[model samples]
Structure formats: structure tokens, C-alpha cells
Target chain A: MAVIDIRIDLKKGVADPEGNNTKKTLESLGFKGVTDVKAVKVFEISLDMPAGEAKKCGEDMCVKLLANPVIHNFSVTVR
Target chain B: MKPEEIRVCVLRIEGTNCEDEMADAFRMAGAQAEKVHLKQLTGETFPEMKRNLEDYDILALPGGFAAGDYVRAGAIFAARIKSALGRDVKKFVEDGKPVLGVCNGFQVLVELGLLPALDGTMSPVPTAALYTNDSGRFECRPTVVRNDNGGRCIFTSSVERGKLMMIPSAHAEGRLMSRDLDFIRKLEENDQVVFRYVRDDGGKAEYPWNPNGSESDIAGICNPAGNVMGMMPHPERVVTRFTHPDWTRNCPGGEGDGLQIFRSVVDRLG
Candidate 1:
């Protein structure tokens, strides 16, 4: 009944150390498949197995609680 | 001589990271300023908090991560400012009061529909100000920007047509976009388009320097009344001489480029 989506920004001035470190580690492992990997903000969400309110609630969470309104951004959908 | 000591208001919110620098810059520019948390303002809705609007000559929204850039950049701030804070901003503009939005603040303006159209007329909902940077990422750099709107904006009066100034921008979604082409052309003809990012050669509007792929390589703009201004760059962050990205080579230019905006508003109070 519910599907939610959230996006997180890489912190301002954050050199994206995770991405650089990943590339280095991959190269040392002799993995050629990894070229670039940027760390992004993630919303680890658990939703109702099925329902409309999940989508609705996700939006509420962003506007009031999860979202800081000063920096981070988000969005929502139901499936 | 000090321009009647204009009183200005600088707002600091949880994600709003620029008020402190903006306040210091305003002080350096010789204006009386009060930086307050919107939480401390005692209001159920945004309009109620506006009690302070009449008390200050200019209202400034500084750049910083607000609401942690949730729901798209500046969306939470937009929502807060729109239904709650928007009515008050509307009143402020009607009275010819001055307002400035920088970086995240610029996003908030667009989200709230207050920026591109404060021409003192029209707006069931003001349809301008702030947009995605089209770059799909954040850009932080120093570059030359040309002022397109002359003395119309209180903060830009000192700017000469074709004058070049420097400011740094940091944002992921800073591109300017509008669906209406006619609207864009009219804004250009009216000289409402204020700031455009230019090449280092300073001859044309080019990429990287412009950062965001805005409609006309636009970096910033003001309303028709010229009282409300918005831009993606951070003027406050570079107010200090040492804040320049290239400080080792140059002494930060005179009080800093951002300070001029504060002074221009105080001058209006005089």
C-alpha cells in the first residue's frame, strides 16, 4: 500500500571521501568495473506491506520531522 | 552620515547556515542588524512572525543547508515560507519593503513563489524566483558576474550596467528554469534579468562559470519592484577578506562583495 522515496545530498564541502576511497580499494583489488562511485544521502525506509497512507505519511515525515527544511531535500510516491 | 542607522533583520533557521556571516557583513557595512531564529519569533503561522517585518528596513535570507535540503533543495523552506511566511512577505512587498534571498534562501523564494515577480502587481501566487541548477550537482567557485538590472534593486544600485563582481555559489539544484518562453523574453526586455554568469574572458555566457545551466545563463534576479532579490551565489560566505578561494594571491577586495547588498538596503532606509 505504500512506497516512499527520499534523496540525500552529499554534505556541503564534503570531499566525498567515500567515493575516492572506494575507487582506490577497487583498483587495488584489480577491479576494472569501478570507475566512479559517489556517496549519496540515503533514506532507509520500511513501509507498510501495502497501503496509501505510507505515501502520505512519508511526505509528512519529510515536511515536519525527517527533513530539516534548512538543508536536505526529499520526495514521495505510492505503489 | 551613517545612513540613519538602518535596522535590518537576518533570519537563522536549523538548516540556514549563512545568517552569522551575513550579520557580520551587515555590521561591517554599517547597518544595525538583528539575527534571530525564526523559532524564537513566536508565531503559529509565518504571517504572525512577520510582526518584526515592520520593525526592520530590510529582510535577508542567507545561504546554508536548510531543512537539510529535503524534498528537493529548498522545498521544506519553501513550504514553511509559502503558506505560513508567504502572506507576510506579500505584505512586505506591497509596502515596498526590501528582501534578499541568497543560495538556499533563493530556493525558498522559488518554492514559495515570491522571487521573479514582485513588480508591485499580480500574483494569485507569485510565479518566480529560484530553480534547479541543471548541473545535477553542487558547484562552489569564484567567478565574475555581470549585473543586468541597473539601480532598480536597492542592493544592486552601486552596480554599473555590465559591471563585473565576484561571488561564490554552493548548491546541487541551482539552475533557473521556466516553462514559458514568452515570459523569459519579456523579463529580458524589461531588464528584469539581473545577474548573468560569464566567461573569464568576460566576453560571453559560458559553462562552468555559470555553474547552473539556467535559461539565459542567469545566476541571479530581482523582482520588478527591485526590492526582492535572489541569487545562487553566497555573498555572505565571502564577506571576510580571508574567505576568498584565492586569498593567498589577493587581499580580499575592500569590505567584500556581499557587504554591498547590505549597505544598499540601509541606504534605502536613509
Candidate 2:
């Protein structure tokens, strides 16, 4: 079985309200030099297939439902 | 068909909390309306509960977090619909039947690729999305929306062109965004934009007046054919005058601004 992990985040130009608020909280805690923050949704999929095939399926999942291409970007990693 | 002959289906699933009000709105407009579970349409429910999409003259997707809005708002519900009754939905639209979605329902329509179906009955993938609000918090407030569809949108046919209507909006993720460069031009050219957020006097809106900062101050849109529409405001909530946020103060009297939407679509059937 192959374990695939997909991480989806708002595209570069899209605003991240939750992530930005988190950054604001961190700065209020006296953390310095926080330029930007990004919040992402991760999905861990267990595929009973070869690593290559698992990766392909993960990409398809992202395109179909896991991530919205209009506002998000996604990456798949197989382990 | 006559208005009384129209069968309106207010579709719902787990977490779809607004079906009752939506169905009531249609019934108030003098149609035969019922709330049907998604399972019923997908054949997962009892045989007696099964419903065919072709049986309904109007389909209404009401507001609420369908499937809990996980994996992106409306993603799960849209996926289930695509897999279960995609063909039926496509045919319904192809036949020019009216479909309305409000608030979270609007999110579902975008996820389902039904609104602004610029090139066809439904896009293979979502061409747009309702992103989280710029305020980073859920907004529940009274808003003004103007009919700009110029009589193209069937749902807004009764509403006068450029007339402002008071509609209450409540949502966390209501900012509509798209990657299409010609989105505004296409919407204008195709007469797909049905409603736009505006000030009480019909002036351009900004910030809270514009609510979630949706692109072009858009609050609602229709498919190119104008049979399908999705809006962020809850018109059902205002079918009566008492439901208005400032009904007592404004005292508009009798029916609410939103009743026209329901009456307009029902009138189409007649």
C-alpha cells in the first residue's frame, strides 16, 4: 500500500483570512519578523497501489474535489 | 403548465438546514413544494421516498452547510450530486427549468458548476468559488441588492430593473472569486449577472455594504439561459414583511421584497 499526502492552500493572490489572523495572534505574542502565513488543508490517503499510481490518484482527487483550482493550489507527496 | 401544477423540489441533505423555509417560500407562492432528501434522489432511501428529478418543475437548493462544508464549502454535497444525479440536473437545465440556490446553497451551485455555465449546461469543473470573507468572521446583516439583469434572469423578472431590494445575508464564506480574466465581461455579455450589492439608494457599495468583498460587488448571478440562479442572500427568510431586519421601522407593509422572487419564478410556470 502507498500512503499519499496532499496539501492544499489558497493560491498566491487569494487572501487567507484564517492564516492571517493566526499570524496576527503570533505577533501579539511578541514573535518577531513574521512576513506572511498560509493556512492549508491536508488530506492523508491510503492507496492499495504502487507509489506512482497512488500519486496519480491523489492528483485526480485534488482536481475533482480535494482542492478548488479557482482559489487553491495543491501538492501531493507519496510516502 | 399552471402555477398550481408546478412541482417544486427543495432538495436537502444532512446539514442542509434551510429546506423547510425554502419549501415554504415556494408554497407561499402558490406551488406544490416539498423537501426531498438527497438520499431519496440518489436511491439510498426507501422506495416510496425515491424522487425523480424530471418530476419537479423547479429545484431549490436552500441555505445551510451541506455535508458540514468540509473539504471546502459545498464540495461534498456537490460531489455527491455530480455522482448521483448529474445527468438529471444537466437535463433539467437543458430543458430550461428554474433552479435557485441561496446562501450556502449558492456555494453548492458554484461547486456543482451550475451557475454561469458560460459554455454549456454545466462546466466539467468549477469555474468559480466562494472564498472566505475578508473580515475573517461570519457576517449576518441586512444588505441591499439591485436587480441588474434587465429581465434576463427568470427569478428576478418581477423585480424592476435597477430597483433596490432589502435582503438579509448571513454567511462566513461569501466572497465570490474566479480566475477567468474575462469573467465580468462574459457575465455582462451573456446577461448572467442577476443582482449586485448596492447602497440603499442604489449607489456603489463598499466594505460592509458590499459585505464579503465579492468581485464586482456581485451578490447573485444566473446561468446564461437565466433558468438557474445562485445568490448569497436568504430571500426565503424575507418572504413575509416581519422577517425583514427593520420591518417594524420601515413598515414596507404586506409582502416583503423577497416575495417577488418566489412569485416571479412561480409566475414563469404559469
Cα displacement (angstroms), candidate 2, residue B177, comes to: 1.0
Task: Output the number of the TM-score-best candidate.
Answer: 2
TM-score per model (chain B): 0.88, 0.98
Looking at candidate 1 chain A, the ten consecutive residues that score lowest on lDDT are A64-73
lDDT of 2 by residue, B5-84 (tens): 99998999889998988998898899999899988888897898899889999999989989898998889999999998
Can you write out model 2's per-residue Cα lDDT over A3-26, one digit (the tens) per residue? 999999888889889999999999
In candidate 2 chain A, where is summed lDDT lowest over 10 consecutive residues?
A36-45
Candidate 1, B1-270: lDDT as tens digits:
255467778876778888888877777777877886665443634674444566777788878888888655666766666555567767877788778888888877666666675344334433543444544456778866787886677777776688766788777777676545576786776566878888766777666888877767788887777778888888777676677666677644545666666666766666
lDDT of 2 at B238: 88
Number of clashing pairs per prediction, in order: 30, 0
> What ranges in model 2 sit over 4 Å off?
none
Note the DockQ of each predicted structure.
Answer: 0.07, 0.89
Q: Report chain A TM-scores, every model.
A: 0.52, 0.92
For each candidate, give its TM-score against the true structure: 0.73, 0.98
